[model samples]
Target: MRVLVYGSGQLAQMMYLAAAPLGVIVSAVDVSNETVVHPVSKEPTGVSLQNAIEDANAITVEFEHVPEHLLLDADKSGKLFPNVASILAGADRVREKALLSKHEIPNCPYLIITDVTDLDNVIASLGERVIFKASRDGYDGYGQWRMQSADQLEKLKSEFAKLDLVKVPLIAERMMQFDREISLVGARDSEGNVSCFSLAENLHFEGQLHVSVAPITDLSDSLQSQANEIFEKLATAMDYVGVLAVELFQCGEELLVNEIAPRVHNSGHWTQQGCDTSQFEQHIRAVLGLPLGAVDVRGVSAMVNIIGCTAFSRDLIGIAGAHLHWYGKEVRTKRKMGHINVVADSHSHLGNKLAQLLAFLPVEHFPELEAEANRLKNYTK
Candidate 1:
């Protein structure tokens, strides 16, 4: 079987790797040039976009920011899996909020702001400390501004005056002081069958994911059930037919939806080594209308993102339970260069191994962090 994937970043690369073993041919479109490139071989070929879609048995996306024209064209071809409606919901925060509300899925209270005038009422209603996000094309910390006080709002108004807020609009969300953030990566088949991986705890730095631990430590069965129910509700609402990731905020015993990712997600990267079926393969299977793979956890796992700086000792391989997957990308500030997965028989064992592995990472890249992490790891054990 052949599949066409939108976007040519690391997620596409990983999908290429996973599809290879299944004898599935995956090709990627640059989205900029509309150029077709073989996923595994990374060889550029001269196939037109129409022909590429015609030849492929299925189409999927690595990310949601695909151009609407291209998505519309693919929809006409009847090859787009998970559909344009689902993709749009993932791309726009307004649409996302509407979907959640329509399904009665719990999420942070939010308002759509088209004018600076609307901000005053929203602030008065929701209070101070709101997160302002661009409704479209925002990811990895860009296209967002935080308002902590009335002064910040005044400044933001000045900033928005320079840009066209009406055309793009923004989502203003009430800031919740949550105890932790967790995510569920689940797959749905055409028949509406769904399977979810264990909930994962995520740690973010400056709006970028830094680390993820799967089968979150001390996660209760009730919490897991709540997360699973939310995922199922979302999948059914969207008529989704592929891997979907739901990020959640846990406050006390309650969980609220933070956002939804229509494709495989960074939080699921630990599943590469920790699950019976990696998310990439499962997504491919779901899109191709194949039976979904098992979502069983193989062991407790931690995935640490290698952002930006490339210089690191190869001796990191010597650290027990360490496995590295590096994306061949030009080094730039804050780029996701690669990731390392560390696994152990139990969460405590995994925590200790991760602490040891952190010591081997260069101090320049991550400073004074290892000591605190080590202290916590030991204390928890």
Candidate 2:
């Protein structure tokens, strides 16, 4: 079987690696050139984009930012996994909010702002601390603005009013104060069999994910049940097939959907080392109409992203249970270079390993590592 993925990025590279042993070929489309390209080697595959789409058994995406025309072209092929609408729901916040409401899934309370006038009432209702996000294209904290006080509303209105709101309207969500953030990744096969991975506790810095710990150390039955129920309603509602990631904010005992990713996601990266079958393989299986893989949490696992700085040691691999996945991309500021997966028989052991891993790196480049490692080591169930 052959699959085509849009956006030749690390996700596509990892998917290609995972699919190879499954007797499947995964190719990529360089959204920049809009042509078939090799995912790992980053070379031309000599397959025209048209022929690639025509020949593939399935088509998917590495990210949601692929141009609309490319998505429309693939949509016409009827081979797009998760479908065009589902992909659009992920790329556009307006569509995402509507989908959540249509399924009665809880999301942040807010209003749409298509005009400067719209912001006034939304601010009055939601509060001055609303976070305005571009509805069409925004991710990892880009295309986002924060309103700290009502005094700044006029300034924001004057500056933002000039924008072509019709082309990229804004979604204003109340800046929620939640206990902690958690993410749930799950897969739905073509036959609609759904399997959810463990709820992972995520730590982020400047809107980029830094670390993730799976099984949550203390995942309550209530939280698990609620998360699965939400995932089922969402996947079934969209007729979604393949891996879907839902990011949530836990408020007291309840969870509210923050956003949904329609493909395999960063927070689920621990599965590459922690689960019997990784999420990338499960995603391929789902789109190919195969049985879903077991998501049993193998052990206490932590995923630490190697962000921006590439100075970290490959000697990190010398540590027991440490698995490194290097993306082989040019290093740039705040870029996701790679990730380290560390597993242990228990959560405490995993935390200690994380601490030791941090010790081998420069503290200046990895300040966040210390706090998270200490939290994990001192964590209470």
> Which regions of candidate 1 fall more than 4 Å away from where they truly are?
367-372, 379-381
Best by the lDDT measure:
2
For model 2, which pairs clash? none
- Predicted structure with the largest TM-score when compared to the true one: 2
lDDT of each: 0.88, 0.90
TM-score of each: 0.96, 0.98
Clashing pairs in 1: none
Distance from true location, Cα of 3 in model 1, Å: 0.8
TM-score of 2: 0.98
What tens digits encode model 2's per-residue C-alpha lDDT throughout 203-264? 88888898899978678999988999999999999999999999999998899999999999
Off by over 4 Å in 2: none
- Worst lDDT run of 10 residues, candidate 1, spans 367-376
Candidate 2 all-Cα RMSD: 1.1
